[model samples]
Target: MLVYHLYSGGKDSSLAAWILTRLGYDVRLVTVSFGILDNWRFAREAAENLGFEHRVLYMPREILERAADMAIEDGHPSNAIQFIHEKALEALASLPEVERISDGTRRDDRVPLLDLPKARSLEDRFNVAYIRPLLGIGYRTIKELTERLFVVEIRESEQLEKADYEVELRHLLRERGIDPLTIFPKSHYQSRVLGWRGQL
Candidate 1:
């Protein structure tokens, strides 16, 4: 079976897709862009390095604007990020050719975590199975997996060129005259997938 792995050019999603491919699931990487920024280009480059065919999925800019406003209102980004992530998941849910979809969200990832009820609703509404292979795995194991399987680049969130929604959401916040640094939690960092170490 084929699965659409939401690619962010980041280590977690790349690892999820890698595992799926090893299990004989044909996987295509898709980067969701709100059209606010061209960060999807970074994702595409990482996808190429990982040897998966990649494509861009465009979502409405207004949805991001809403998320930005919510973040500013709440003085934090957790709910807003989860909202944007679900929207991105829903955007990917409608592909007629795909029956399964996956992402990099893990056990301890609070922001952007898809709760069971919402996940089931997405599955029920779209008739697609939302598979999250990392949710059952903890942080330390994921770090170990990335260490063994990937060449990675790490940087502070805004400095990295990866396609994680946080990058675009930060841009959206900047557009609204609120510096993303203020709304975002301190000490945030991001990791981009440089390439796989070798075939498993």
Candidate 2:
């Protein structure tokens, strides 16, 4: 079966898509964007390094604006990020050709994840199977697996380059003359997948 894994050019999404391939599913990487910045290219290059077919899908720009406002209001990104993520998942599932979809969300993710009710709602509404390959895995195992399978450049969240909502949110904050640090944490480390183990 063909499955589209929401990709962000990071180890998590890349690993999720790669696992789908190993499980005998024809997997394609899909990167979602709001066109706020030319960030999707990072994901495209990462996909190329993984040897997976990749594509980009534009999401509603207003969704990003709303999420950014919410993040600024809340002084943290959790709820806002989760809201954007769920919406993005819905947008992907609503596509007429999408039957199965997947993402890199893990059991340990605190932000940008869908709960059972939302997941079920999506499945019921779109008739799409939502696959989460890393949902059961913890942080340590995920880190070990990513290290074993990918060549990644790790940097603090604000300094790293990866194609995901955080980048655009930060850009939005900056564009409005607000430092992203006011809305996003300055302490987390993020990975930018350089390539597969030997593909670099």
Provide the overall lDDT of each model, using Cα atoms, as 2-decimal numbers. Answer: 0.89, 0.88
- lDDT per residue for candidate 1 within 1-200, as digits (tens), equals 98998989989999999888888999999998988789899999999888899999999988888888899899999888899889888889887887999998998988788789988999999999999989999989998999999999999887788888898999877877888889997787889988878753
Off by over 4 Å in 1: 198-200
Residue pairs with clashing backbones, model 2: none
lDDT of 2 by residue, 45-111 (tens): 9998888999998988899889888988898888878988888888889999999999999998887
Cα TM-score of candidate 2: 0.96
Number of the top TM-score candidate? 2
- For model 1, give the 10-residue run with minimal summed lDDT: 191-200
| Candidate 1: pairs in clash | none
